[model samples]
Target: MIELTLIGIGTGNPDHITMQAARAMNAANLILIPRKGEAKSDLVDLRRDICAQVLAATVRIVEFDMPVRDAGGDYAQGVQAWHDAIAAVWREEIARHLPAGGKLALLVWGDPSLYDSTLRIAERLPGVKVSVVAGITSIQALTAAHAIPLNPLAGSVVITTGRRLRAHGWPPGADTVVVMLDGGCAFEALDPAGVSIWWGAYLGMEHQALESGPLARMAPLIAGRRARLRARHGWIMDVYLMRKEPSNG
Candidate 1:
């Protein structure tokens, strides 16, 4: 059986990797690094850089081209199909490299458990004896970068995606809503009256951009900056936290 370990390597900065993640990376007999063909660059460079810094020189490293997801059709169906394609690739790589059945690892961006599909993909690999090593998440990175608390005193935090936020609007009973995977900056549609926002782009990276304060005041700035950053870098990953003013409630 293949002993599979999914190691979380934090967001972007290599230093965000934890000691546990480092040890997991070093212990793996084989590591898979996925390259996204459509992205501006290999977004998984975190895996390669971490391996260079943490993995033993003799440890085997293999790079594979990741399959692009079909953006057409139903969103759920498209994602499930994409996962199947990814699992097929993973099976092929592991079989070709570790036909003897040994410890294998794949470096995950941020914590695999948070808004990530690595765990779900691992589920498709039957009898692989999967294991996980947690690392810092983009939420943590965003909060840390903004130097702010993620929630109000004795309040609940709801983490969601841009699509959901756009479709459903503000969720009831949520003290703070942290939105991720928001390429369209869905906050634009929100009633910006008493809501406050803290937005950060490329968190934990050298060119990190941050904007905060009243949603009305910061919304346009965040949108402009996001466009500029994406134009400059060809790709961007960002997250934001929004909450209604306590006084307004």
Candidate 2:
């Protein structure tokens, strides 16, 4: 039986890796890392760094080129096709490296339970026993960096993707909203008045940047900063939390 473990490494910080994740890495017989093109080489580098820091014994590390999703096609269909292609690549690599079936691992950016699709991709492989080692999420990292809690006491928080946020307005009955996987600053579509925002980029890494204030005041600033950072680094991963301002009473 093939034991596949998906370990969350957190938001690009070596220290963000938990002890459980470290043990899982060291225990794995092989680890697979994905190369997301030259523009986002930092992602591969970060995974390499994590392996270097955690794997104490000899373990096979295989690097595979990731498939790009077709953006021109229907969104859902494009993503499904892309995932199928990636699964094919994974199967080939696993057969080549561990034909007899052994323990394998993949490092995920954040907790698998979140918006990440590593778990979904793993489902494509048959008869592979899977395990997950949770690590810090970008949300937790962002909230910590800003020194704020996720929600007010007894208040609710909604976690949604940028695509959903743009498609649907502020979720009905949502006390606070946390948006992720947004290439564009989707918050600009909403009325900034009565809303406060806390945003962070490259969160937890050395080049990390943060900005927070009334949404009206910070939306444009964040958009500009996000553009600049992406241009400079060739890629950017960011998250933001927004909530209606407390009643002045």
Candidate 3:
């Protein structure tokens, strides 16, 4: 049986890795790092850097090209097909490297439990014993970087994806919302009058950028900045928190 360990390495910063994650990296017989092509080459480089910093000399590193989803098809169906393709790739790579079966690890960006699909993909590998090493999430980094609590005093916060926010609009009774995986500026769809936004890109990295202000005032600036950064870096990961004015309710 192959022992699969999903180690969360936090955002793009090497220092974000926990001791437990480091230990898992060092102990693994092989580590699989996915190449997301030139557009997101930095992602693969970050995984390599983590291995370089944490893995033992004897630990083997394997690289594989990741499958891209079919953007033309229905969103869910495209994602499902893409995930199956990835599972097939993983199986082939594992069989090629460790024909007899052995311990393997994958360094995940941010915590796997939060908006990550590594666990779901692992489930497709029947009889594979899965282990998880939790690390800081982008949400944690975003909140900490802003020095703000995730929710108002004793209030609840809804964590959601950008698509959901765009489709459903602001959720009912949720004073604060944290949005992730938003390729588009979904916030522009909402009435920005009473809402405030705290946005960050490349959190926990040297190239980190942050902006906070009334949604109406800062929405355009964030959009402009996001476009420029994405053009410059070839890719970008960002998250934002939006809160309605407490007194307005």
Candidate 4:
């Protein structure tokens, strides 16, 4: 049986890796790193850097090209098909490297339990014993970067994606909303009059940028800055939180 450990490396910061994740990385017989093309080659490079920093053992490290998702079909079908293709790649890599059951690890960007789907892909691997090592999330990094609490006064915070926010507007009963995987900056579609937003791009990195204030005042600034940052880096990862004051309700 292949012992598959999904280790959360936390926002590409080597310091964010938990001791448990470090131990798992050291113990793995083989580690798979996915290369996400030239535009995001830095992502794979960061994983390599993290391994060089934390790994003490001479474990086998292999890099594979990440498959691009087919955008022609319905969204859900396309995503499912994409996931299947990724799983096939994983299987092929394991067969080529291991050939026999052994310990393997994949360094995840953040806690697998969050919005990530690594666990779902792992489920497709037969006779594999799956384990997870948690690490800091981007939301935590975003909040800590801005020195703000996730929720105010014990208010409920709804964590959703940019698509959901743009399609449905603010969720009901949510006092604060954290948006992730938002390449489009969906906040522009909101009313933004009474909402306060704290936005962070490339959180926990040296080139990190942050902006906050009333959404009405900060929306354009955030949009402009986000565009410029993406243009400069060729890729960007960002998250934002919007809070509606009680007075505005």
Whole-model lDDT, model 4: 0.93
Query: In model 2, what are the clashing residue pairs, if there are any?
Result: none
Worst 10 residues of 4 by lDDT: 240-249
Query: Least lDDT summed over 10 consecutive residues: which range in candidate 3?
Result: 48-57
How far out, in Å, is residue 109 in model 1? Answer: 0.8
Q: What count of clashes does model 1 give?
A: 0
TM-score of each model, paired residue for residue: 0.96, 0.98, 0.98, 0.98
Query: Could you give candidate 2's per-residue lDDT for residues 57-137 as a string of tens digits?
Result: 899999999999999969999999998999899999999999999999999997888998888998999999999999899
- Per residue, candidate 1 scores C-alpha lDDT tens digits across 26-112 of 788898888886554747665667777876646799999888999998999999999999999999998899999998988888888
Q: Please, what is the whole-model Cα lDDT of each candidate in the order they appear?
A: 0.88, 0.93, 0.93, 0.93
For candidate 3, lDDT tens digit of each residue in 33-100?
99998999989888888778876658989899999889996999988899999999999999999889
Task: Please give the clash total of every predicted structure, in order.
Answer: 0, 0, 0, 0
Alpha carbon RMSD to native, model 4: 0.9
Estimate the lDDT of model 3: 0.93
* Residue pairs with backbone atoms closer than 3 Å in model 3 (clashes): none
RMSD of each: 1.3, 1.0, 1.0, 0.9
